[model samples]
Target: MLGRRAFLKLFGGSLFGLMALGGYAFGYEPVIRLDVTRYALTPPGWTPGLKLRIVALADFHACEPWMSAERIGSICAHANGLGGDIIVLLGDYTSGTDLITGKVGHRAWAEQLATLRAPLGVHAIVGNHDWWHDAAAQRSGRGPTFSHRALSGVGIEVYSNRSVRLEKDGHGFWLAGIEDQLALRRSIRWKRPFTQGLEDIGGTLAQITDDAPVILLAHEPDVFPAVPSRVSLTLSGHTHGGQVRIFGWSPYSPSRYGDRYVYGHIVEEDRHIIVSGGLGCSIMPVRFGVPPEIVVIDVG
Candidate 1:
């Protein structure tokens, strides 16, 4: 029904728009947007005077043209300057060795991340990508991955199906983490469906009793419902805020629960989950609408 000139004009316009979008995604969006989202957490407890500031960083792919060492260092600097009481790292430190740029390695990334400091402490958990590359070693009784050791070397405790009590000024809260979802499966071969890892929420919870308030560090938000209501908050970062969003929706969310837990804060009853957009990209190094973020949760 359209004339020849009209078709040509429309095609040309569409082409131009696509190119512009690609350029923005590949160039500007990845670097320019570093958002610091602040969330107020008023959990079930009635401690009106209690306040805690937690800075969460996740999914620093740590490779390629996007996440160079300099950029990672800069991100850590910003995190340190944020004045958080505690800094928590959600995983995905590296995509692939092949994707890494010059003068960057797992050790370097770990060292840079080590610079992140807070009065309370720095804590971390591994992601699916971390297990993907080293599942065999991690499963073959090779102890923790080298990356895990690197994190621990810098005083950042990597909690794998474990729990620890964090105390400040006589107020204490339970901080726990489970193994990444992929690590718990029989095998995490590439191209296979991601089954739930052997996350021991009960065992981790058993480490603490008397309900002093709980915050869980899970690499994926899929573990959200598995967490008991005794937990006040859960922090996850594997979704990358859907990587890209259209009118606040991302077409490709790497979550079994779909976009329901894709990004930001999701509150169900008294429990809460904060999914960070994360610091880097996966698959394709492009982000649109949903920029990388460092989430700040203020609990009182």
Candidate 2:
């Protein structure tokens, strides 16, 4: 049997530990930690002798005191130093949670992102929050959402069910980006039954005119299983590695498939997907176990 003094000490210690963990999650991980995660792979049908380095940033829920324009600029500068052949922005540029002290303007972040430098240029795709938070687009069930317009206004091409071809050292491949899979809410009043998606996977793939290998940029990893083998690789964010993970398991994942598509490299049926643990928080401003990351992929 435990003594009264021992029980009291144990309870106090546990409370202190919990408070300390909460402080780290709220103050340190999301605000100050930035990790550079790297992966290298040669997809099943990639062109021979062709090497591509891709630097990707995702889910910048831009807000004051969290993801400010100056912070974004610093991140962009770091990415530029990486010497990527191409850079991809993986969406959710707007504030994802209402816990922000102040919202970041679209143009402010866009202007900072414009500083990003890559030989093949910068490309972008929209995320669910980009559509859900846009009042005009949500009301109308369509977009040129603010995120899309802001990115395009800054000279970065934002793809919506679009494909473009790029070459490196004479080897050509198609880069495709589809619209967000959860672009709109079925009911703003109830916010349930989110059945609508702006994505057109088949339509996007159809635009690829050649047999050259393809890289697909999707905002959510849920689309990976449905991705055809024709696409050599699919890159995604939006899960943020469940925002709080423990021992490679996330207790609360926003993904319908849960931890299966939550983070890192996933392979199925000769197809590959890399899901980034994105920068910034959503639903709440807290992070633990999974730190903010800039993903770098070397593909052949």
Candidate 3:
């Protein structure tokens, strides 16, 4: 088996060099975003006068052959194609272990993928990669990926354990983004006071009106099982439907969480979870049983 880096060099060269001849000639790269616009939710005692559509893309890893600027643009175009009102991105911007090499690829690709345009607005939280040097090391020798500034430029809100309110038609909802518990490695040093649980973020959620429906976005599904039952819905990505599935099942997913939340919609009573296949690839560039996905959720 070839090393991941070596494979990327070969794959990226093929992808970029083939550009002059027109689009790459390997396969039918698509601009497909799963249309879940019909996904409906009715909070108790809530009148249905409003509709909300969100585009959720996650685990970018931003690798060479899998996550090219061209491909991401395809996904973005697909998202815009949705007549939906709002768009949200989960996380994981790039995939690399070496900071220097990773950042170079991230900067180059990030510059290109920044063209996403959405109507209600785009929001995101960092994935393990975006934090685990899941990004560029130092273009000029800088830092890791979590950025309110850089992502904001692309119209994606980068949130870490934060919340915001959206209201219309005399009804309202609260959206909260919590820090990734799975992404605990990078945050160890700075966490002086030492907090053990995600409850630290409950204060942010408190800002919302108590009766309003609330939605949460956390990158890793590992975070979902722990979310308080109070949260109405949670959105996530990072598994990539095991990135490579055998036959049709994700042979690679090892968590006890099961395939219940693998890819697509999972509804349990009032608790709903959406795990997107995302627009990029990681760990390995090739995909089987899973095409990269952009998930749209219509919550009213």
Question: Number of the top candidate by TM-score?
Answer: 2
- Candidate 1, 1-300: lDDT as tens digits: 989999999999999999999999978888667888889868775256657899999999887578887889898899999889999998888773354354357888998998888998899998877766666644563337666777898888899889898876788888899877766334455343544465678888898866678888999898898788888889999888999999999998988789999998898877888899998888887899988888898998
lDDT of 3 by residue, 19-96 (tens): 632331113221232333335565443436766677676766655454556666666777777765667778777663
The residue ranges of model 3 lying beyond 4 angstroms of the native Cα positions read 1-38, 43-47, 96-104, 134-149, 153-155, 186-201, 254-260
Most lDDT-accurate candidate:
2
Sorted on lDDT, best first, the list reads 2, 1, 3
lDDT of each: 0.82, 0.93, 0.61
Model 2 lDDT on a 0 to 1 scale: 0.93
Q: Can you tell me which runs of candidate 1 are displaced by over 4 Å?
A: 1-9, 96-103, 135-143, 184-196
Look at candidate 2 and tell me the lDDT of residue 246. 92
Q: Which portions of model 2 show Cα errors greater than 4 Å?
A: 188-194
Model 2 lDDT tens row, 57-160: 99999998888888888989999999899999999998888898898899999999999989999999999999988888988788999999999999999999
Candidate 3: pairs in clash: 61-94, 61-95, 103-136, 123-157, 129-134, 138-141, 138-142
Consecutive 10-residue window with the lowest summed lDDT within model 1: 184-193
Which residue window of length 10 is worst by lDDT in model 3?
24-33
